[model samples]
Target chain A: MNLKIALLGGDGVGPEVLAQAVKCLQSVEVTFNHHFTFSPALVGATAIDQTGNPLPDETLEICKNSNAVLFGAIGDPKYDNDPIAKVRPEQGLLKLRKELGLFSNIRPVRVYPSLIDRSPLKKEIISGVDFTIYRELTGGIYFGEKKLNEKGTVASDLCEYSEKEISRMAHLAFKAAKNRRKKVTLIDKANVLETSRLWRKVVTRIGESYPEIELDFLFVDNAAMQMILNPAQFDVILTNNMFGDIISDEASVITGSIGLLASASVGTDFAMFEPIHGSYPQATGLDIANPIAAILSAAMLIEHHGLNEEAQAIYMAVENAIINNVVTSDLNPDSRFGTDYVGNYIANSIVDTD
Target chain B: MNLKIALLGGDGVGPEVLAQAVKCLQSVEVTFNHHFTFSPALVGATAIDQTGNPLPDETLEICKNSNAVLFGAIGDPKYDNDPIAKVRPEQGLLKLRKELGLFSNIRPVRVYPSLIDRSPLKKEIISGVDFTIYRELTGGIYFGEKKLNEKGTVASDLCEYSEKEISRMAHLAFKAAKNRRKKVTLIDKANVLETSRLWRKVVTRIGESYPEIELDFLFVDNAAMQMILNPAQFDVILTNNMFGDIISDEASVITGSIGLLASASVGTDFAMFEPIHGSYPQATGLDIANPIAAILSAAMLIEHHGLNEEAQAIYMAVENAIINNVVTSDLNPDSRFGTDYVGNYIANSIVDTD
Candidate 1:
């Protein structure tokens, strides 16, 4: 098998943690006898510093020409702190998503048995929790036409959705559900917003194609509450961009392992995987940032390309590391392990596996 | 003191639970020696069934004429289950808020010491979880202009905010914070939305006037995660209507007492108090619905009218009832006490107080 993977180590601890994922991928290549090429591209604040453009033209080209892209993280405090800054690091990732046509952001949240006690929720409530969120990207209010009156006293943002957009993500959610629990909960405010009504109508039609999968609906507010009260009940949660941003983030913390969550964003012909955690600007060069999320993202990248066995090998290695408490300070505060040690440990585990 | 109260027992268990609140209020009148007039009106599905209107003109007239309005729950499963129904039980509430200019919706989430064990979150995360959410009502996405394209394939909803809308709620939140921990966290998506940036600009200026109050900002997504990860860190959360609806609901469950949560919607000239819980259509005639929320709303109504001592008395009596285990089945599953019993016990506790 031959694969070309684009690496976008955006900013802060991104490059540091992403290097660990590369080591694991190299180990996979050695053990599985696969030919893999890695293409490194600059993005976010790093790109801005060198090229003055968050998403340089060459970076997008490399990503477009790859089998899949494995992203580390984006954002920088220097840009975040200045409210008046014209160009931002996040705009780079947003542009990359748009340019690559990556429209569905899928995040899976599962409670690891070894870390169940670390969660804010009771062990009984979150013990068996396993769910994925299929979020519609590239549409909705985030990309909507924004307006401010001449006097600057009134401001507005439009939240728009097309049947095409709704059905695409709905199909993805249904497809994912077919392989898992066979249930999909569409989170929207159908009773209030016209867009939500359209979501319900379109998703309902999509559900018919996958007759074996069960379809249900929950208002966003109730979904937020239910996520805490009984997170185990959910299988696949499909929602629009804004609601998805809130719900997925809320779901991330429930597992007590934000550092271990990974996400995949895909379109018709392109896919990108990344850790859900932001670039920890404070942990830059400190060698203390967790690398499991990035390593798992590398696993998702392989899984996206139908390399299931290879992906599972990486997953098993990561799980072994977690169970043995070989982690950075974030997971085990008393541990003296650094980012390199954890990454090298997981990579060696993957290679050493029969 | 003399007062006139409008009671709108809306739908399902609304009337039943409201009857309990009225009993407690009657006890307050007897003990505090206040003259009060009670006027009952119809709203929600009951109003739709009886008068063919959710918010009848006569009901609005009664509410406007009264000094304050104490509302019961709203909505019915019949109306909710029918997606095409033009008139909904919730339309009454939205219309009433608009007509009365109720621009601020305030919900206080407090963890009751007696109900700590019921919380889904570990005790350490929820203990001392006392915060108030000041949600800007009568504006934003829910009330925004909505459009479904001619082809019925596209839909959009506008989220608009004016300086006035943001400032009024900012003042309420800041004022509340002055009486609280003197910190206000504004939740908005300022990083992406033009409206949120406007919110930040306006709220930041408002914060200057509140020199003693500390101000901070959090994106809605981060705010949702923080609400669960560390709920006690918040003193007052000020946000737009949509975020408030979701965050307040999320905050409600953390206390493990959604049935005991109360809310107040107020304007310069009019005020309305109601339980945050919806009318449980399934529990309509079962005599199992919790009345504590409605009773607490009655307490807030008195507080709104400058009856602090009287309100505190009601709070103390309700707390005593909860402490003594005189609660409905919702709070104590083993107890055989029904809604009527809990209501009578709290009412008697109020009257017997020294």
Candidate 2:
């Protein structure tokens, strides 16, 4: 099969990481009898610098034409340090999500035995933790109308959500649960938030349609505790965009590093796979940034493409590489970094040895 | 100085826990030569069964007349199973908060040395984890418009916040930072929610008032990770209701048991103190529910009243009791029990030791 993949190497170490992702794709292609066409695009601070638009027309076109988009990372300290910058790096990424109608951000947390000790959680606590979180990508207060009223001393943000938005995500969450351990935990603040009450009522009504799966509604507070306490009990956690972003990152460390987690934003006709970690501008060009997250995101892309065998192959190779100590300084900061060198190593393992 | 304290030992193991709290108050009174009158009232499921109103007129009158209120656990599984029930136990608590205009909930998370191992987090990660969370109460989506759509297939809730609502909380948070570590992390989802952006902008404006205090904004997601990775980095975490609830509970277990935390909900004219743990209906009448949280809330109440000596005395007694292995089963479940017995032991220690 021939696949056209959109490559979005946003800002910071994004380019360095994408180079490694390309190598992984090359290795996968060589071994799997498949062909991949790579098209590069910009969507972060770098894009703003070049085209004056973080997510420019050329970039969107590339992504629209591709079977899937592989995002590296975004943001820059320049924009981060300067709070008043009108055109920011994050805007591009958020725009892409909304434009593409990417409604669910899927973040999977799985502890690798080799790095369990690195987790802040005790071994017993984090040992068997494995779960996937589906965060609503485009709705809730993030996309709401924001304003500064009465000479800027006063500010307000209107958070409004339609039932259609809730229905679409609920469908995805329900589908994911059907594939997982047959349990779905909808995390919301229904007890307090009107939005959450709406969430509960919608999800609960939809829940009746799926009796085979156990549906549980948790106030976000309890969900946060349960995430760290008994992570094994969870299969798929469905929540709003904000809840997902926070919980996913919190759940990220349960596995290892924020730099080691990957997420896929799925829409009606487009899918964007990216490492959930932000652009570490400090680490740009330092080859020490962990590429495993990007590499794993590629693995997710493969699986999403219905190439489970190829996806499983990449996962196995990546897992083996970690077990064998072919890692970057981000994972083991004490060691010297072969940043892209680690990706090359994993790619080599996938093709040479496997 | 004399104070009127209204005590409501609601339902389940509520009365037993209140007994211990009363004892601790008496102990503090003796140590500081401070006298306070205690008037007990009924609330929660207990009140519902007796008077058909979770927050009875008598209970409200007592709480309103008193200088402060001490609340034990509430809820009954009977109500939990019946989601459609018009009268429920939690309603009383929520009503108390709304009626009294308890606008800020302060949950203090302190890692007890002896129980550090009880946490799912590594001892090193949690040993020095001390932070206080202030959640915006009586506002946000809790009071927003909730509607079930025409098809009954969609449910939606609205989350709204004005600048004025957030300003008061921001002032309190910045002031807290100045008093403690001079650093405050505001947890919100500015990236996604307009409400969150409103939070950030208002807090940022209020922060100008406290130039000496270092203030930073964190997306709720990143804050969640930082909470586990570097909890000591946080002194005062201020956020809206839902986010605070999630993060606070998440912070609770990192210190120890959910049964080992206390909180205070304060407004202009009134305050309510309660253990962070929910009413463990299963443990009701078993005399095994830990009362330290309730006891600790009393300590907080004393501190609020400027009875520092009395507060410190109660705290030392609770700590010393824990040190001496005189705790309820929740703390050391294997051998600890007779929740009443644990309360009595702590109360006795409060008197005999000092």
Which candidate achieves the best DockQ against the true structure? 1
Q: What is candidate 2's lDDT per residue for A279-307, written digit by digit as tens?
A: 88888887788888899999899888887
Clashes of each: 0, 10
Best by lDDT: 1
Could you give candidate 1's per-residue lDDT for residues B308-351 as a string of tens digits?
88888889989999999999988998889898988999998885
The best candidate in terms of TM-score? 1
Cα displacement (Å) at residue B132, model 1: 1.5
Model 2's CAPRI class is medium
Clashing pairs in 2: A141-B193, A141-B194, A142-B192, A142-B193, A194-B157, A195-B157, A221-B246, A246-B221, A287-A339, B287-B339
Q: How close is candidate 1 to the true structure, as a TM-score?
A: 0.95
Task: Report the C-alpha displacement of residue B11, candidate 1, in angstroms.
Answer: 2.8
lDDT of 2 by residue, B1-354 (tens): 798999999988788887889988887677667888999999999999999999998899999999999999898999999968998898899899888989999998888788778888888778777778989986776666666557654454556778778988988788767767888899987766667877888888889889998887888888888887888888899999778877888888787677878999998899999897778888887778889999999989988888766777778888887887788766776764567777777777664244
Where is model 1 more than 4 Å wrong at Cα? A78-88, A351-354, B48-50, B77-88, B351-354
TM-score of chain A of each: 0.96, 0.93
